[model samples]
Target: MSVLIKTVGFSLGLTLVFTGVANMLPQVEGDAPVDVKVDLSALTMDDFVAMGEDLFNNKGTCTLCHKPAPLGRAPDVQGTNMVAITTERLADERYQGKATDAASYILESMLEPSAYVVAGWGKKGSDDAESPMPAVDKPPIQLSDIEVDAIIAYLQAKDGNEVTVALPSPDAAAEVAKSDAAPGGAGAAPAPAASGEEGLAKYTCTACHALDSDDTLVGPGLGSVGARLSEGEIRQSIIDPNAVIAEGFPAAMPGDFAEKMTVRELEMIVKLLAEKKQ
Candidate 1:
């Protein structure tokens, strides 16, 4: 019995050491959360355009598919003059949309992506008729109306064209910011996801990574991810995706989840994914 007690004590000590070491690691991934609150006082064209640029690269997730060839699945917004392209698109017989000007074209193109599928940018096997781009005002990439307009303003300004899109009224913009704002700030933020399933739906992870079944989407199957990756690894993939690109997929996961997910919400989904061992 003395020998058994000694072994038990040693095992308990080892358990405490492992627990302490785990707690010593960083809690939040990357830096402190970037407060995306829009400055209501600074509603100038410059500010709005800057916000648009930020969204285009960050929240908007446009670069995922809009990269230059041969990787780009969408039209390269940077390489080609989008303003000029909009002009030609409006004139094209294939143009089924209602936007007659650049600002409208950009807005319409985002919300009504299928209205004008750029010649070769359509979804595969659709004969250039279907677009893979989701509406910016909709799920997973829910940019508010003001946010969408901000993108148009940015694009126009970036192309050296006049910013014809109207700046959002302070009151109107504030309402939008308020609804999505976290506790402290009145900046634009994603609608909250209260549960693990809600988070998966909000971010639409199942669109690419499967929750169950071998029938995965575009990205690799994540059905048995926990059996494969540790909880820490799953958390890292969500927060700092590019840190370790999953073997067969591009470094295409968004790098801004650290900002989007609340700590509890993040842990909820992480726990859910970590249990996906089947």
Candidate 2:
């Protein structure tokens, strides 16, 4: 009877030890979390506004298109009341978006940019009906929803207008990052374009320059640039943009394409932009 009691006590002790070990191990309830999965909810509006500024300049690449007027490929909000103009945009005969207010108009503009192309800023051949700007949620400049709202908030606050966008939540941030990261997310730039159209879209050239058409954009019409500048001159223009400002246009071409573009990308873009005269 004493042997039996000893054996039972030993078994119970082993079971307790195994239970303790299991408890000490890290407990993963489901799938592994993304490395960048972060709770953005705690970030204050002021912080997001500042973050928006940085993103607008860098990560979001908004400055690449939205510069001072008569210079930017897109409408330059500089010194312009984006909020006041938004109301006008909503009331325009051409306005087709579902937004009922300023904040939503800005957000919708970023998401479904084709919904209301600003006059004279549409893609070539779209008759001022289709914007050339890519949806900010897509590749090349995939600003997360929170980041987009931050930009709206910043823009609104910048113009002394009321910010109406809701703050981000932990789940929303985590989910967006996780989803966008799944398939070559915001961090990945597309490979060098294989064709002229691809190159044009990839580099956002059509935003400012008319490539195959006479449509007036922010930059000089490149439809016949080859009739003017040599191939080497075209290369120089891209790499050292500010060196030779085109007459009647602001020196607004981004000067950092030398750093941002790969050799293959540069070559393809140059090939497309510099068609030698026959």
Candidate 3:
């Protein structure tokens, strides 16, 4: 009896120690929880891009719902051109600092989708407007304002013409600081754009193209497309998709849908694609 009691005690202590050790090791794979410690202020463009990629691929888990468009919508990473969808609309001066860019708009769309309902895309027959992107502002997925800023910067860079971002000038920063102190200063992030141009990819574009920054899928990744095509070229590509087929890519983009899609929708989709950048 004495030997058996000693053996049990040893086993219990060893088990506790093993569990504690496992918890202490920095993020283990598979079963381990992620330990993100990104310092936004110190991050370079590369770092920001990496973090944005991480958010898109892993942590924020955007792929789960807003997948690339080709396969089909929802529950699949099919045809979504998220990069283009995010850029063109954010470029509008009206978006300044408030869903002003693709990243911010995506963040806003992620956190609050109901504020601006995308026409024809709102949840059918719902009481209040319902957004498809789930709310991720709670607990583990909670995003800090600075992190949100980094994400916006990253996406903007991805969509901008492969050029270095013009960092906010000191004067702009000072104005921002002043605004932060004012009433409702830089208040809660604005709701995402319900404008058809901004909302198209989220609703239908992804149904045919992938929207990721680093990879290709049903459709090619639109990383630096902006650098290669003019607005007119992009417009023509959309209205007459078969006119210029991207090498190694199928011209399988549904052309017969010209009748199904309005000219405005075609223009918006084309313009969005023209904005991709690495």
TM-score of each: 0.66, 0.62, 0.38
Model 1 residue pairs with clashes: 37-187, 38-187
- Best-to-worst order by lDDT is 1, 2, 3
TM-score for candidate 3, please give it.
0.38
lDDT of 3 by residue, 1-278 (tens): 35434534543454455453223222211121233544334556777666666665555545544544442224331233445665654654433336754445666765675544443344434332554444555433455444455555555556452423433343444544554555323332212223445534423444344454523433444556567777766555554678898777656454533433333334456556666654
Alpha-carbon RMSD, each predicted model = 9.0, 18.1, 21.0
- The 0-to-1 C-alpha lDDT of every candidate, in the order given, reads 0.71, 0.68, 0.47
Tens-place lDDT per residue, model 1, 1-278, is: 35435534543454455453233333322232244667566679999999988888866777766778766656788677678888899999988889988888888889988888889766555676766677778767777888898888888898788999888887786686666555423432333456888878666675456578544234556788889899988888887888898876667666766665555556678889899899
Scored by TM-score, the top model is 1
Badly placed stretches (over 4 Å) of model 1 are 1-27, 30-33, 180-194, 201-278
Which candidate tops lDDT? Answer: 1
TM-score of 2: 0.62
- TM-score-superior candidate, 1 or 2: 1
